[model samples]
Target: DNIWGAVALHNFIEMLRSFFQPVNVHVTIADGNITLKNDALLEILKA
Candidate 1:
């Protein structure tokens, strides 16, 4: 189940990368927290 979860996450990231081409996308999971970084996303949120 953990492996499946990882695979699903990888696929999701790949999908996001394609959708946000030309922008750097990063995802970090630590201490039970998830952090995502992307300038494009920030712009969307600021709008």
Candidate 2:
């Protein structure tokens, strides 16, 4: 059915996104400098 196919497609997209998406992680120093990938930040915001 259409509903089943939509669910399958959504699952596939999520899987692909997870597999291809990169994570943004940071370690701060006393100097207070920040560095991170924008894509990772966007992903976090999407969640």
Which candidate leads in lDDT? 1
Give per-model TM-scores.
Answer: 0.51, 0.42
lDDT of 2 by residue, 1-47 (tens): 24564477568767767887856433222323333346454344345
lDDT of 1 by residue, 16-47 (tens): 98988847767754523533356454443345
Among these predictions, the greatest TM-score belongs to 1
The TM-score, computed over Cα atoms with residue i paired to residue i, of candidate 2 is: 0.42
Q: What's the lDDT of the predicted structure labeled candidate 2?
A: 0.50
Deviation in Å, model 2, residue 3 alpha carbon: 0.3
lDDT for every model? 0.61, 0.50
CA RMSD per model (angstroms): 11.0, 13.8
lDDT of 1 at 37: 54
| RMSD of candidate 2 to true structure, Å | 13.8
